[model samples]
Target: MNTLLLRPDPGHEKFGLGPFFRVEPLGLEYIGAALLAAGYPVTVADLRFRPGATAWVRRTTPRIVGISCLHALEYDRIIATAAEVRRAAPNAFIIVGGHAAASYPAPLEHDLIDAICLDDGEEVLPALAKAIKKGLPLTEVPALRLKTDHGWVTTQPLPERTSLDLIRLPARHLVERHRSGYHCLLFKPVWLVETARGCPHRCSFCSVWQFYGRTCRERSLAAVVEDFATAGDSIFVADDLFWYDPERSMELAAALKKRGVFKRWILVQTRTDLITKRAEVMAAWRPLAKDFDIFLGLEAASDSGLEGITKDSEVTDSVEAVRLARELRYGINGNFLVDHNWGEAEFQELWDFVARHGLQRAGFTVLTPLPGTEFYEGIKARIPDQPWSNFDMHHLLWEPKLGAQRFFELYAETWKRSILNTSGEKSLLDWVRQVKPSQWPYIIRVLWQTQRMMKPDAYMTEHALSRAPLPEPAARQPGAIVRDEGGQP
Candidate 1:
């Protein structure tokens, strides 16, 4: 049977760091590897290219179509893509799965979709395809919410978490044609390497831990070393927690060194406390790359703010992490969550922290209530109907305590403190010096698009567009101006 896997272009990539990075769909590639090993012909199409879902369906003529939904903001787009696939390949068995779809299958439980994979696709995809190929009931497949004539029904659960070693190396050959397009910042033709899966930390604003049941799984050290040695010079490690196990991490680093693997750049995401406690493990891995960068979740500037979000780590850990990484000659890229409830003092505190630590490279995001988390469940009913795109963490989902206009002004001001602000410390010339002449055009375009985050008007305009008008009162004076207590018409 011929199967097609798709990675849809996030429908709303106009804002945030969307313009800065575009990595390959490592998840679909892994699934494709599994299917191919099962004797199924597989085609992985990245929908970001021209000739979209409908076109790909006609060309591939696939018996099974898998669509990826990685973010909550892409929910609407995924549904629309499913409809297109349904029209193009009416007989195709359509399934949607990824971090988003599996975590909260409710958004994807539509007639257009045949099932939603509630677990790792590497195991689920092969089994689902086998069931269909053998003319067996899909109910026999584990870890799925299968669609039936009656309604969507849950299938038997997987006996255990899907092992990461199922596929030694992803079917990267499927996406090789688009390799040059995959990048992070100045690193073109980047390779995405996943050494591990899942996160154990529970941050209220994040859905990663909840989706994976707070479990961290690692691939075999040999598989990881092979992947690192064979991958491109610039790699982005897609692990939710990069150094979760200090011993395993040290072993992996030593294994890679033994294999004589080195890279131009490697980026990994980990927690602040991890860096503080496992400084030796970090030091051991430093020799693997010429320029290694760590993306730390410095979610807040104070202990109280961190505690409020159940971050479990204090502000001092963040300080020490930055100090240690810099001392070890590792590039640091950190992010902080900005709450809508924050007042002027809160913003000032964050700004002070950033300045004091010389962390202008740190990015900021609005504390969004992402779907499939406790945060979203608590506030979903209160929020008026809005596009899932607004949940990009750049748009406001509700009226803020400081009001929309003022809130956006502070938000935009916050972004201006970062190094992306070309009008501030770094100029166009400074950015140009960092890249080759051929890359200048691309870098300039990215910098130009990033400027939108520093403008209050841009955010406010999008915010106003997403908001619905309030219903008028049943009775009112003829010339009366109806306004909330905060004032203004």
Candidate 2:
């Protein structure tokens, strides 16, 4: 093979991006397709499903080995996996790419990884592969970082992909083992398709705009239709904010419906305000390419909290959006921000909002200052001893305003209220509907992850003692305590 691409596992003991959700490495596959198009033979191995992945890499003697570290949490695993790759094949050119690589390359500038592709690997990966194949000088590849004896050197930033219409479909055939294993929770074997890349909005907590330089380049409707048809039924439109142009989304829906591909359910992420303002879009969604579930970026319940992160929508927009989704019989995954600065009242307020919406899923995230974002440089060193894993959003890196244990307790209680109560009926129904023996593993894994979060200590990746002290249990309200599954309420 000319090049071998691998997606490293994010080393979360209880949960993972792959095994937990069964998501395929869409970006890596896209790069693989572009490389193959350039006459370079490509092989992809998603290490999550490949148990003997190290041995697999050991055997492959490809000229170039490319690995992806898409999330910051995968930093340790990326380094370890790259080190293993080096040990297995010292002669191969090792290139690390993805969002994490571009955001934080200083820590990854080690002896194992030879080069790091800074951004959009579609153009850079193929170019690098072609250069390696022809033994050409590597100076021309855009958005590239090289490790030198003294320090790291970088090339001019690559222009954001202007023509998303030209990129080929991701080579799904490359990782066939991941096909059945890829899914979103109980939604078995879910496929991923993208309508657009990059976001126009400048959310402070997010680095999407910074990574793509505030660009919102979208694929043509025909290209999107083709991609949807390629992915078949049950797709996740992996766009950061799919609500950019309401007319475009409606046009795509019309195309999907006109093609008579109605059985497929798509999951998309978008702002709540879009759903509320564009009622016609939601109306079109019912028959033509209707969304199965929408990841609504309702990042906060309070307008003040929303403003803190530069979110444009008000609290009422989220409420109205959720109401519309419920009326239309669609699931809403309401995402909210959970900060260390929150007290008991704030957690309660968030829980009340979720409960009021009758939302089945509630996603929470700590106010992380992700690298390449406007807030990163300010708070990167605030938590001196925190490992990169803490940045995954489950762990609290800073001292909590309500103290450590109280904050974690509130977190667990609020999560249980959302998970156990908000969607218990649907969960039970899903459990009853599943007939495949293969489905149990996924369901059980999901259950275990959910149950683990009930305990405050489950969030502890490192020493909890390093932060604020846990308050006495006697001081907390009886209702705030997490209930045992088999125990009384």
Candidate 3:
């Protein structure tokens, strides 16, 4: 093999125990396309589905091995894979990239990983491959950190952003064996596509905008339509914020309609502000992607919590977004944020909101301070051990008003009671009744996964919080302590 690419797994699988987990790693696929365009033989080992990845690396014996460490949760896997690859193929040059590596490359500076990519791998990986083939020094490669005798040295200044047309469509055909594994809620064979890159929002818990150079860039509308046409009947436009610019969204929709292309099930994620504020844009997208579904960033219902997370919308905006989805008969997946700070009442309130709104799909996760985000920097010192496996958002990073076990019960029991009658039943029937007969196998697999998740032990073992450290006491100021209103000093 000339070159082999892999997407590291997230240590453990917690499928329906919490939020959705495995989606295609578009970053590696994009880089794979670039490598192919640059005239290099390449293969993608998407370990999310392909088992025995280390054995495969040993068998292939490629000259260059590229691993994508996209999420902080997958950092543990990155370390394990890098070490195994080094053992399996001692001569292979291992290069690691993706959001986690870009954010915190120091942790991966071990015995294996030859270099860490600090920018978009689309152009950088291809450049490195060329340099390797010609026996040129990688010391001067831009947006790269080569492991030297002293330490990792930064080569060149990282570029801000790359043109979206850098490589048209990811090398998705490479991972076609696992095609049946991807889906959005009830829909099977959901093709994940990116119409644009970067996010404009500054939500404190997220780091996507910062990693993408803190700017919103669009793929030319023509490019967007061309790519959309190829993603079969179901599509998931994986934009960080889809309608960040309403005009561009409308233009893209008009272009798609002109080409006489309409996907049966279209899924996209955007903020509630877009739905409530720009109703016309939602209306326009209806024709281009009928049977449209939305993943709304309705992070928190309380204004204080929303402000804490820097989520730009209000409770009212989320309400309006839900009302509009219900009226339009569009499927809804309203994601809400929760943390250990909450007592039982807060979870109960969120549960009530889902029931009242008739949301067909919903997701809730404990707020984790992932690396690369401001939240992580603020709380890093208090966290005793930075176990990458515990960063899945299912585990709490800090101690709570309620103890960890109580918090888990509150989160699990509340969701169990609220979802089964509401979104759970509705989504199950929708898939069984409407999906193509050929897709029954995939649908049945998904339902089985969901059913297993409903059992009590799944989240307990899968998302067990024993690994999470308790929150440190508040730091005392210079001034002496004083008695409070309740006489507590």
Highest TM-score among the candidates is held by which one? 1
- Taking all chains together, each candidate's TM-score versus the true structure is 0.95, 0.90, 0.89
Best by lDDT: 1
* Candidate 3 accuracy as lDDT: 0.73
- Tens-digit lDDT track for model 3 on 1-489? 388898766655554332233467778788888999899888888776757567778667788999998778777788888888888888998999988888777777877788999877988888888888998888867788889888889988646567886665788887888877766655666788898778877887787976775688788887778778877788888788888899998888788889888888888888888888788888888877668888887876566567767776688888888888667777787777777567676777777777777653676767777788877777777876757777876666655666666777777665565343225555566666766788666665656565543444655565454565455532321111212334332
Per-candidate clashes, comma-separated:
0, 2, 1
Instruction: Please list the Cα RMSD from the true structure of every candidate, rounded to 1 decimal place.
Output: 5.7, 6.2, 4.4
The collision pairs in model 2 are 22-182, 22-183
Score residue 447 of candidate 2 by CA lDDT: 65
How do the residues 1-489 of candidate 2 rate in per-residue lDDT, one tens digit apiece? 468888877766442223446578888888888988888888888887665456766666778889898887777788898888887888888999888888777667888898998878888988887777677777667788986665677877666463676688888889877788777755668788788888888778788887887788888888777777767567777898886789897887899777766645678888888889998888787665444788788887777667667777788898898888778877787777777666666787788877777764876666666767767766655545456676776776666667767877887776776553325444644663553675876676566565666667766544353343432322211112122234222
Among residues 3 or more apart in sequence or in different chains, the pairs in candidate 1 whose N, CA or C atoms overlap within 3 Å are: none
* Candidate with the larger lDDT of 2 and 3: 3
Give, for candidate 2, the lowest lDDT window spanning 10 residues. 474-483
Which ranges of candidate 2 are over 4 A from the true structure? 13-19, 159-162, 289-291, 420-438, 460-489
User: How large an RMSD does model 2 have?
Assistant: 6.2
lDDT by residue for model 1 over 1-489, one digit each (tens)?
889999998968777888889999999999989888888899999999777999999999999999999998998899999999999999999999999999999988988899999988888899988999999999999999999988999998889987887664898999999998888998997999999998998888889998888989999999999888989999999999999999999999999999999899999999989999999999999999999999989988877778768888999999999999999999989898887666787888889999999999988998887888887887666665778899899987766667889989998999999999999999989999999998898899999999999999999888778856522222211111122334222
